[model samples]
Target: MTRHDPALSTPAQSALDALRANVAVPFERARAMPKAVYTSPEFAEAEARHIFAAEWLCAGRADALPNPGDYLTMQIAGEPVIILRDREGVLRGMSNVCRHRMSTLLEGRGNVRSIVCPYHAWTYNLDGSLRGAPAMARNEGFCKDDVTLPTVRVADWLGWIMVTLNPDAPNPADQLAGVERLVGHLPMRDYREVFREEFRWNTNWKVLAENFMESYHLPVCHAGTIGGASDLNQMECPEGEAAFNYHWIIKNDLVPLALAHPSNTVLQGDDRRITWLLAIYPALLVTLTPGYFWYLCLTPDGPGAVNVLFGGGMSADWCADPKADQHFAAVKALLDDVNVEDKGCVERVWKGLCAGMSGPGSLSHLERPNYDFARYIAGRMP
Candidate 1:
């Protein structure tokens, strides 16, 4: 008789084994990821340490912080970090915790000349150097030059602001080179960020991420919003690389803003109608069309919740059009509806997983991106 060792069969360990099993087969024989991969707290903790803390995470669009002093703060696997443009107009990332007392320095997205700790009135320059402290004049051998917030790794890839706590993490540009080769003609770096919002959802981060990666759910779940527009047969999902997965669709002109602007002569033929769905490793999901782009940067709150930084805007061609304002208004309204539909679908999936009887089934051919995504997740597990 086979004996099960309790020490070797933890919830997290069992989930890891299931994930390995799921990704072991080729796409033709693959199945959906097991429920424990999304519902187990222990597994979530392991992911937090091995993936979120170790990978480069998208903070938001670098264009959103165009002006000096504009800054945004985020927490990656419980580490508070700040991304900002300093006085010299340099993009930087640094620890957001105060040097003296460890209080969180900044709250959210805003423009700040300097970071000031509310607990003790200790101030830091936009470059993260110490500017002042309220009562440290008489301290023994204390020099302001020696005091500064620790710098975190920050990179501007295309237009996205990427932050990482891992000092040895690979350059964002190098890692996403495949994505640039596929969408380089779209001028993604110049796309103006028109809107950004952060919200928490009552679902696992991977559940929402997998939902975005595959269009198979569009016809059913997003029927009220974008379902009728999505043709599964038109999507082209090639094999994914180590860093990202992308599938492109030749879109119809149902939404005018989804096609290239008349002035965008650079895009011709089918290129003008191509919409690329890019899933950057770990948690950046982007929907890039010729005229506009939108993205979601996900951070796990726990096994049952995800914190999202959602934003998007018009391409340079669209932004320069005479009817830019009117076009953006329509596109924004459509995005809001699409988001509503997605929220409903993914939340229900999470709820079903919680019922404890849910089991993964055979993956459809349309779910190729999901299979690649599952492989990415499984590869991240140590």
Candidate 2:
């Protein structure tokens, strides 16, 4: 399918080309990252270099490392890595592969004083330093420093743990200025890590992102929840950075034609636009409704599997009354359906991308948000 994908949207050609026409952007960068970015081994490797290994990637929330020594194990750009809070209460990320023999050091998130690899009984401190060895001194000319886990770079922004697999990655604080300016005053950080699970997806990560860039698909795919409230006309992304912030606001349920303001004359069933779902480039999406929030982290496992992790957050006073409680429940249920629908669509797109029917494709006239995302992707490439 073309960039618009019937259910999706894209920006006008003139407007998009204008933003990208700057001589600073190489021709290859202006063009899409190419079909290989979504389907080929080479493109994926390049992304791993410029986007994952070299850039600060959001891994999870600070709460994952709440207490000292708590840690979360995840893969960044297909590299097995682990994030740990040392005894001093600082967060650090290191390659998860054991330094001695390449055994995985940890799996999932948990509390551990010292990570002792089950394979050879080698141990690493919370800060990723070599803490113990099965029989290191007995080996010929083996230096203890050489056996320490290779540390990756890490930075925490607004509670999200970011890992940079490339040792020479830039200062994350500087790299995130654009996003920081975009969300400066929003009450976004008041999130709690209440939920999470990983799903293996068979589609390109971008296809999944396109699914979320706008509410155009609400009226069709999510008619029961979001389609009931939001429509194509009211589904506008905010201006400038807000458009890329991946944030939205809604006051009603996801019912079709649901009214934004439910007065006495407004029917309860009218779906009228009361939700915001904003995504960061590569893959991270946040959904903000009247009283609830949902965050999705889409980490590409490989060309074949993408890890989609979901979590729920809410206001401090969500339990104020029965109505607030009810709204939260409804929001969670609606999002569940959203995930079900997205899974089917992306799986199909993955099939199409792998089929080689198309190489790299262009943007649709109405999908400006995606094109904007494309702009960010191009800027990020080395």
Q: What residue runs in model 1 are displaced by over 4 Å at the alpha carbon?
A: 1-9
TM-score of each: 0.96, 0.77
> lDDT score of model 2?
0.62
What are the lDDT figures for the candidates, one per model? 0.89, 0.62
Instruction: Please write out the lDDT profile of model 1 over residues 1-382, one tens digit for every residue.
Output: 2223344338888898888888888899999999999999988988988899999999999988989999999999999999999988889999999989789989898999889999998999998899998788899888999999999999988889999999999898898898888899888998999999999999999999999888888888878877888688877778888998888878888888999998777889999998999999899999999999999999999999999999999998899999988998998999999999899989999999999678889988888889988998887777
Backbone clashes, each candidate: 0, 28
Off by over 4 Å in 2: 1-37, 143-147, 167-173, 238-275, 319-327, 354-366
Best by lDDT: 1
RMSD of each: 2.5, 8.0
Output the worst ten-in-a-row residue range by lDDT, candidate 2. 1-10
Q: Worst lDDT window (10 residues) for model 1?
A: 1-10
**Global fold similarity of model 2 (TM-score):** 0.77
Error of 2 at 380 (Å): 3.7
What value of lDDT does candidate 1 attain over all alpha carbons?
0.89
